[model samples]
Target: MSKKRTGVFVCHCGTNIAATVDVAKVAKEMAGEDTVAFTKEYVYMCSEPGQESVVQAIKDNKLDSVVVTCCSPNLHEKTFRDNATRAGINNFTCEIANIREQCSWVHNDKAKGTEKAIKISRSVVRRVNRNQPLDAIAVNVTRRAMVIGGGVAGIQAALDIANAGVEVVLVEKQATIGGRMLQLSETFPTLDCSQCVLSPKMVEVKRHPKIKLMTYSEVQELTGSVGNFQVKALKKPTFVDPDKCKLCDECTAVCPVVVPNEYELNLTARRAIYIPYAQAIPASFTLDESVCLGLNPIVCGKCKDVCEADAINYDMRPETVTEDVGAIVVATGFDLYGQENMGELGGGKIEDVLDGLQFERLCSASGATKGHILRPSDHTEPKNVVFIQCVGSRDPAKHCAYCSKICCMYTAKHAQLYKHHVPDGRAYVFYIDIRSGGKGYEEFVQRTMEDNDTLYLRGRVSRLYRHNGKVRVLGTDTLSGQNVEIDADMVVLALAMVPSKGTTEIAKVLKIGRDKDGFLAEAHPKLKPVESVTAGIYLAGAAQAPKDIPETVAQAGAAAAKVIALLSQATLSRPPLIARVRRSHCTGCGMCVDACPFIAIRLENGKAVVNEALCEGCGSCSATCLRAAIDVKNVTQLQIYEMIEACLAV
Candidate 1:
């Protein structure tokens, strides 16, 4: 509000910005301005020494505001903020001018780039004068966690939080918790028994004193911020008593209605009322309400009549549960892209074509085919099976641009599993690349190639057609750069791994960011991989990105560590950079109110009140208001305009 006393620091950026623009000339030109307290330039202004210039100027010139003309704010805003705080200046008093990425990175002409940089710098100075110092609103965390999707990731997260002496609520949409892992016969590389490794985690989550496993449940509404969140979980009726039933197979064997078994990937017949698999967590049976006796009541309660536990609750109704939590881990995992189309690939049109998970089940000892590589059309063992990879991945033109990171490894694993099961069975794997990049990953691929007698052909299939009880595959060999065709008794498609179906829903509820492909977006790729853009919420497993078991487990640990870090604090302090409106300025015209994005602005005491929790410190509200009443603390309009006046000599 007083005289404009400004300082500008231009970064050489090691020729990133310096090569095209004259940093020293720009600084000197700005220094000539009467309002400018001082102007300086340096190489790597983001570097330690460059930051020192800002602090030194703030003290030496008694500057009222600071502008760091560097790269994008997204990269190092926090760094500059911390520097300002260290200098006894309000962190928001500083503003970052994007002269590098937006100007130097895009423009080649020296003078034009420099001119554009000045314009941006001037705009920021104009904007920052309106900025005011705002404090971050810190709410007490409940110290409880919610994990979505009770697969391995959820199980691991729940166990970690529970083990740490905190409460965890796990929600699973399915009636069981095993997820696709239970469907698999063996895990890759080491080929360890899938259930053997997964079952222990599931049991721990179910039995944990601090963990509440809610199967057949969906999160209907998620509200509040990271530390103190309230979630409404919808528990759909399973029609069977979870407490009474002891996982006896009696109900399934005698049920009158028989349908295709989804657990077997629908390869065999199963009663309508049945458990997903033998090793299902909770290891209990579920009644398919659509076909079960009690649904219409027209049919008989044969399952209940047969059950000695009287576990059947015919009057069961969907229930809603509200739980409070301090943090959340969205490890809902993923689902394989359903290859229902690509009629040429025999996706849903043919009987013998199966996805990777289905094939996993078929290869398992507890599977429909009893660990035999058999044709679902007739239950006969197949002598030859063709594996198709990248069904709906890596092609932006068709399915998705992402590579679905786990597909290549899992397909190789599938081929290896097929070879192991049917020793004499010929396994031909069609792939785009072998992406076993993690620990023991490369060696695993080599072992599969050398020991399994599996044929690895690098190519993409053009078409597939079932003829004479066999599918004829037409493809091109990328290695040989030649067209190839083959007929196999059965075909296994390694479908693309995709984010869970409820990913978008969860993203909206949690307010955590998500990229275009539906995978949860992290705050920063390298620096904050496990953290979501939203604080107090962490992500792990395939829900965030397509990751293998080892990576998923490691991420689970990282997420747990983050929770522990948050809990470690004796008293959380909200950073003093969030937005707040001046209640006394009082012209409730509502222009600033409409501009607030996070709904952090509220009508409190009959006036427009800016909620510290909702404000992003973006200063959008300050920009739109005609009255100029809105101020984003520290980086206020007065200080920024002073900086601008200093820069322009106006």
Candidate 2:
């Protein structure tokens, strides 16, 4: 074995390190080492001139490996690797030692910072000495993307990715493509009709040449990794053929069985065979086999008799589709916190007590009351309505601790919309604090107060019950220090927005992570807000966190851009740092099989085998191995010991 010649470069990072640590001293210390061929210090190694100098030093010193003491590898690891590659060295021969963030910024004393920087650099040098030159593994990228969920976020992502010349498969569990956005009557700030803005996008998704719309479908399994993901989606039967069915209401009119319309939040009744709403994208009806007469037609078959297109099919069964996609965008949207959880607020027992979506129905022109804004129990106008904010939110003992981000603005919007429909009606709101953090959001809240004369009380309701045929809300006004009581005709609970049902399950299936609050976890909360820890998978909308319409749309577009960027690449170059199993030292105990977090290790031919593509180099398998059969590439147990010795050395 020959001695490894390493080149070390220290970066000042424009006083980010120089102000706190001795960069030149660290470079000089590394130069004194026997393995170091040369050392250099620069103001910014990431700068063009600095990179040029590094390439020049590598060439002049005939260095086998390069070590950069600078910022985190996340920022400029690629820059130095490409620098090495340009200088006729394998890119994997380059290593990064973070001094600015890990050493200088973390320490206040100059001596301590300089000492720590030198130790870190020495560890990198030692690690580089053991590092063998390797080539990047090129994985072919499939030129297609898949989007789960059919909300505004999912629709936007699918359309954007599809328009970018990449095929997209858009899957929605519901019969229609539109999510919660379709149920709303109006959106905030501009008061634009919700469907007016969303319907066009829905139509575009259906008509787009690159998009394959799969409504009434769900992803059952996700396999493989980035650039080559295999997905199995189960598409439930809608019974009515979208291509064959005409948009006539003949079938719905002839059907005698009426069930509560879920789209209207049970505020209205629809025939057993019906479309969700008038603006449903496919313009097709779906037969509800659960409530409809029977599959055999022995009980009733009125809908089949009235169908002009003969589109009714009782034998329609669920179909499974297999899709190969390069990337995935998860925009599963959110579900409102259930009213049953708010036991203090009548527990949904009071007839007039409604959730936010139910109130949206009352204001909608197509609602059962025909936009009358009447109380559900009495079918009469509520002269005084009470709106409670954070019904199941910000209550750590009973509900969530985080604020339901959109409640304040929507609550104000609801007040304004309520006022618009009923000029004579008065609205009062109870809130801990109003969080209106968006363009024109504060102004909208102000208008609700000043223009609509909506009363704003800062507090929480302790109890709610029916009194004298009206809902009585008992709570304290914290600002005024008064125990206020209000007997309102109707009460609307601004329920907390929770991650949509099956979010955790879907995340598990995708092998992604979720936060404590059940929202999808981003790779980095601020930097990589869209990408998941799992490569090829991205997140959008309230599925990641509680966000309003504008934010959700923006995130969706950002996610689409990420997908397009991934699909545009002909082949993806993965880092050489992956796990390898030494077959000679193997004792097929299968401990690593269970200990591996990524499930990358498996027993093959009575020996432990590793799938390099699936391994993230987390070292969990290696740590669990007793015989030291597992070792991560670019890293070794000897290098770890040398690093520890370097840190402890005087």
Q: Pick the candidate with the highest TM-score.
A: 1
Give each model's whole-structure lDDT.
0.79, 0.90
For model 1 the local lDDT of residue 186 reads 86
Ten contiguous residues minimizing lDDT sum, candidate 1: 128-137
Model 1's C-alpha root-mean-square deviation from the true structure amounts to 3.5
Report how far residue 559 has shifted in candidate 2, in Å. Answer: 2.1
Per-residue lDDT for 274-345 in model 1, tens only? 888776777677888777655654567677778899887788898999998878888888888877856568
Where's the lowest-lDDT run of ten residues in candidate 2? 292-301
Error of 1 at 501 (Å): 1.1
* CA-only RMSD, every prediction: 3.5, 4.2
Question: In candidate 2, what are the lDDT values of residues 1-650, reduced to their tens digit?
Answer: 69988999999999899988999899999999889989999998898899999999999989889999999887789899999999999989899999987988888999989999999999888888888889888989989999999999999999999888899999898889889988887889888988889999999998999999998888999877799988999988888998899878898888888988888898778888889988887778899878887766676778887788999988899999999999999999888998888888998888999999899888877666777899989789999999999988988987988898888988898999899988999999999988887899999999999999999999999999999999999999999999999999999999999999857668978979999999999988788999998889999999999998999999999999999988888899887688888889889999989998778888988999888877878788888889988888877666787888888774
